[model samples]
Target: MTVVGKFLPLLGWVLAGVLMAEPASCESWVDLNVGSELQRPNEQTVVDQTALVRLNTRYSAPVGITLNAHYGLAHRVRLVDEPGTGIAAAQSTGADLRLWDLPTELWRSDGDTWVIEQNLDTLHGVFYWGAQEFTVGRQPISLGVSRQFSPLDVVVPQRIGAQERSYRPGVDAVRWRNPLGLTGELDVGWVFGQDNLLFARATQQWGTVSAEFTALTLNQAQWIVGLSTQTFAGDWGLWQESAWLHDDVLSGARITLGADRSVWSDVYVVAEYHYNDVGDAENMTSDFFQKGLVTLGKQHYVALNASATPSPLVNLNLGLLHNIQDADTLLLGNVGRSLGNNTQVDATIEVPLAKQDSGTEFAQIPLRLAVLWSTVF
Candidate 1:
């Protein structure tokens, strides 16, 4: 079926539900964003422009049921000053670049200069009763302890440096959660697809500490177990997450440890270290584009991020990521300013540091600058 054919049916369903809902109980909003990026690598320069629109609506029925629907439209264009640069590199590398910035379900390429896409980010129904809730349809399910990187976020993991981090891609699934006690809960979910995912998680809290344990099965063949925890000591926050996968081909573990603290009431600093026992240091750069157990192919990684807000209207962020095995580093910096009540603007820059080896991970990335403008209505 065509993309429009698939979208029209979903749109009709949502509209029908909205019509049946109470008039004053439905809420809706539209968000628009425009972004431009410039990248330079070697002697080549590339420019990309993108526009995105999102329509979100929620309805609360009188009988404790809630419906949420979110739709998105996007258009992107890329221009390269020289051949064999930027996206060309990505294409030659055989990386699934579309997964990084575009939706996969409903999209089409328009000639060689433009790409248009549409997607349903969320279409879910929830039934709430006391401390128990059941959700069905497409929705996001996140499980982890770390904020920046999570080894245990196996279900619908967010892409690194994603533009829309607020919402991860939703999965077709059924999930149930119930409170175990005053400070505990149990969650179970099943995601349907070719490689189906089934998992159960238990969470507990004590004082200023919280912990979670999960067991998951993939395709009824591989098993994965995860543990994560977070605790507060004085003014510092500490977290750790670990996952172990049992498979014939890819059997190993990944772990991450992190700490964060606030300074001067307006500045926050965070540091994290990640270790992937299954990662390959020799093939780190080449294998990075391949689908694998580890998100990053290098064995060890360290990252530091700091954010400061000098005033209510402006925020500054700086971050650094280092690949210990390959000795490659990436520097990130961004500034955000609130334009008004419902608008904002941001500027960001990323610089990769590595030897002049085309195979190296950081060397393949260009120095990039991005400007973004967004507004909500």
Candidate 2:
């Protein structure tokens, strides 16, 4: 079966959903980006032997447009379409239909409601549902402790021309939010398809803190578990998230802690530390969840990130990151401004300092530059 093999179900779901709703509002956006990157692929190492790895340099430019429409049919059903940029299989587009406030008037106590949404693409089939306020499906999941990218969910890292990794798509799942007794939420997911993979995840909150766990079975063969948390202090926001991965034949772990505090109004600083311990170093960067055991480049790092909005259409971002264990470091700065009601341009550059006797990837003189233009209405 090819990649399209997984899209049929999603198509049917979305079409059926659109049919049940009436179109009401529409919006669309387009993005064009081109950039160059030098990537280093890891290889087997031998003691007393030197393995020289060279960077593979390349450039890519892609254009994508997404158009979405919402319909209010019978005051309960809504139609939606989220088409793709058609550049790559990983980022293909799709559609969906959502039904809200169905046949549960008695169960919808004051602040409670029920809804069901479905996607119309085999590559992304989602069965949406919820009770009193909780909903579940095979949709993409983003949890705590993440920056430009997520560390706990490190399955895929690049979001350029097209998607390249497997997304925990919409699946058979259940979620109950602020149920009759609980305060935060409760979710259970059991997914199975093509490759015959199974996954389960759950999350809850205590006062100002939230925690979660996720388990997955590969090809219905190996099992892995993860634990994570998020909280806020008096003047700062803090988080500690980690995963303990174990299969019948392998075991590994990863953890990251970060905090942000405001010094004054509209100005703040952020810092974080990430650690990894992978028994097989080769497994590093397999997925978002498997950073392995050693922080890639074995880093104890911190960053000072700040941003400001000088006008309605202009903004700036700056940050400096340094690794404590190695002499590796990164200096970042970027600015973005809107050109029109629906179009904007932005550029960013990352400059790396030379290594200091410590063999770290960031210590090398690595540089990345890029510009992007996006528009929507």
Give TM-scores for every candidate, taking all chains together and pairing residue i with residue i: 0.84, 0.58
For residues 109-213, write the lDDT of model 2, one tens digit per residue. 222212222222112222233434333333344444544223345322333111113433232223333333475445444333333334455677888988777
Query: lDDT value for candidate 1?
Result: 0.75
Off by over 4 Å in 1: 1-24, 41-43, 79-81, 84-111, 161-164, 281-293, 355-358
Model 1: what TM-score? Answer: 0.84
Query: How big is the positional error of residue 127 in model 1, measured in Å on the Cα after superposition?
Result: 1.5
* Candidate 2 lDDT for residue 193: 38
lDDT of 1 by residue, 161-196 (tens): 433457776766779999989999999998764346
Worst 10-residue lDDT window for candidate 2 reads 44-53
What is the Å distance of residue 185 in model 2 from its true position? 3.1
